[model samples]
Target: MAIHRKRFRVEEAIVGEMPSPEMIEEAAPMHSEIMAELRAIRAQMAKGTPPAPLSGSAAMAAIDASTAHELSEARTMLETYRAQIEQCEKLKVELDLIHDAIDRTKREIATLHGKSFDGGEMAKVNGELGAVVGGTEQATQQILEAAESIDQAASAMSKVQSADQQKRLADDIQERVISIFEACNFQDLTGQRISKVMGTMKFIEQHINAMMEIWGGVDAIKAHVPAHVDTRSEDDKLLNGPKLAGDVGHASQDDIDALFD
Candidate 1:
């Protein structure tokens, strides 16, 4: 039986709108690469490898098979590219959340540190600390002075200051020292606030570290951002605000002043 070549209109994907020049430029390389493969296949056909004076139905089957394979390959590429784009979008969202968290955490820490220690705020806390410390110091000195007075009275007792006189002097010293102790209650108030501040600082530090981990650990965070080292001394650190009374790390006002010198 003599076979006739089948005539069929090839189905092509229709363009709904004209592509922009930029879009065409972006697509050109992949288009050229695919065309190159199709050309190589055609070249082999011309060399008569399939010896295509193929019967008409056989020819149609060959075209269908090749078209199907190419379409399958295109679909695979499109699916892979779409998956990559989705992955990129998800990554961007995660990075943005972590970045925003870092910024917010930093602002809160700054507020805890006194809103970047704005001049007015710094002075206010400084004044509060100074007043508390000064009051405590004055109360302590009064106690010392009272003790010295008692000592002086005892020293003079050798001059036959009678038992009644010595007893009266001792009673006066006891009342004065006890009054100073009462005045030293400022420590209780200051300690509560200072402890609260310490707790806030620890919480901020932990939150900052968590943000760092989200951004991929310390090394990754460093890779993306510059690191800053605090140049403030240990004493300066303690003196940043009021410390508990007799805190060994606290710098005296004079010591802090000497830092500038």
Candidate 2:
């Protein structure tokens, strides 16, 4: 038995060493021609037919060049994407900081007011208003009842025939008028009480504004409050004070009565 050795040469292609421009230029035409021919052949062939083989050094070089180009493009794209992602993260952090600032503002404002949205000051104001209303209502009712009594007395006095009876009736009328005048005194007292209540409300409002400044404003208030759906329309948002009793889309006294009925 005879053993034969096949010898191959080793070419040292150092770092950064690449195929010559001449070789690449030479390979280009052949590569284009071959690719064009192959494409034509594939076009002529039936569907699913295996394509022709390309196996020369030039063909390999061309493939390598193409692959390198694709890799360069992919690397560029990856760097761009990374930069974009970094920017997005930065923006997100800034947005978070803005949110924090807003929350802080709201908390400060809440403090100034001595209360929050459903704060103690508001409850106190509510109680005060209720007391004022009750007092006024009671006073008005008493006046009405007194007036009715005066009317009854006048009607009876009108039917009297004697001078002495007339004199007595006139005296009773003066007394009733004096009683009416006394009933009106409640108004002065109620006005004073209302003025006190108004002062309290102003104080509460000023404190609330101070709280806003302290907390960071609306943001802080919202953080402490639970999220609720805003059902008001753009128009409704501008509305102020109590709505009319029988307004559209609102339940009136009749509707309330119907619940019990």
Candidate 3:
């Protein structure tokens, strides 16, 4: 085998020495660029490598965070459902109370109708009132007629000179007075008829008060009350009947006499 050897010149020999501070400063930019390119090559190599699995504590922390979030959402939904249930319960209770009230009102109305109209109580009351009016009118006419007859007999007695004629006139006046007394007996019948009418009216009033109580008291229901409408004609409105005992705001016989005076 042939032996070959390469010879190096002394001027081309390599040397080793510390770099100057100015040279280091001038190479700073190149050093940074080289370092950045080396980091980029490392990142490309790491992309193909599988990442290390999480440690025990890190994995547990991630799982706990997810569980806490889910639990919080579940609690919020449960709270909303609980509130809805409470609202539904309140509405059900209110509806039940209203239904019971309606049922009671229906029963009361049926009872009132059955007793007042269907049972003929209203008709009986009307008939009784009519009888009272008729009896009062007949008695008044009879009394007036007797009074006129007595007045005529008294006037005749004053004019008569004979004792027999005067005695006859006095007897006729006595007879008329007795007739007036008998006509006054109609007051007893009027009282009985009025009592019957009063009883019927009282029954109706009791039922009406009960109906009013079903909704609320008179004061509670006052706002719902409709305005009253007068249906009477002007002449009918002026036709007030005789005042009862203890009635005020009406003119008596004494007041009329005073006016005349």
Candidate 4:
């Protein structure tokens, strides 16, 4: 009988160890509460809520601190990116100014050459004028080369993925422009010619400002103008009358009479 009783007790212990549906149902609410608390903690963290005092090991605190540091670093990186983009935009404006200066120099050189040639004193002033022309031509070439370098640098800076590269290019372009302006000798001329060149440069500056106001920058102007359209108009074409009027296909006696009258 005692043996049978022990056997019965052993059977009861085994049955208790096996999982039961009732027991699982009884523990479901506790499991759900734990999950809800975890989700709430995550939500608070996402909303930038301050952390509560924790009883766990230092590992969790270290992870949290590292995550915050990374976030701060990311924000700094983004600010740096925005600053670089702004600097590039500013550099573009400077590059446009340089291009305008180069164009103005070219026009002034052309005007000076025209005036010197048309003055009709070539016999007396040929040597002096020739030297001036040579110097002007050299300066013009240098200005154009520098302008091209600036334009290319601006373009490269715009395309660059690195902020440091953009900064370096911008600095280089600025330095080149300054160097060109300093190296140019505009002091040899004695009177109205120098004044006229200065006037031209001023006019160029005004024109560039107007263009920037209308279109934003050099790139914007390029975007607006069709690439295939020739900007230069021939002198002969400007002087020529309309071909249709000169064709003699549709004239009347009344027109002749009116002209005579």
Best by lDDT: 3
Clash pairs, model 4 backbone: none
lDDT of 2 by residue, 1-261 (tens): 333333333333342445556667779999999999988878867566675677798789989999999999999999999999999999999889878867866665556444433567667667777777887787777778777877877887889888898787778777877777877887787787778678876766776666565556778777889788979997886564455866565556687699998
Cα lDDT, all candidates: 0.73, 0.74, 0.84, 0.70
Candidate 4, run of 10 with poorest lDDT? 1-10
Cα lDDT for residue 181, model 2? 80
Each model's TM-score, in the order given? Answer: 0.47, 0.43, 0.67, 0.26
Q: Model 1 Cα displacement at 55 (Å)?
A: 2.6
As a TM-score, model 1 comes out at 0.47
Once fitted onto the true fold, the runs of candidate 1 whose alpha carbons sit more than 4 angstroms away are: 1-52, 99-103, 106-116, 161-261
Better of 3 and 4 by lDDT: 3
Per-residue lDDT tens digits for candidate 4, residues 40-62, read 98998999979666667776998
- Model 4 residue 31 distance off true place after TM-score fit, in angstroms: 99
Q: 90-129, model 3: which lDDT tens digit per residue?
A: 9999899889878887887787788776648778878888
Model 1: lDDT of residue 226: 65
RMSD of each: 21.6, 18.2, 12.3, 33.8
lDDT of 2 at 177: 76
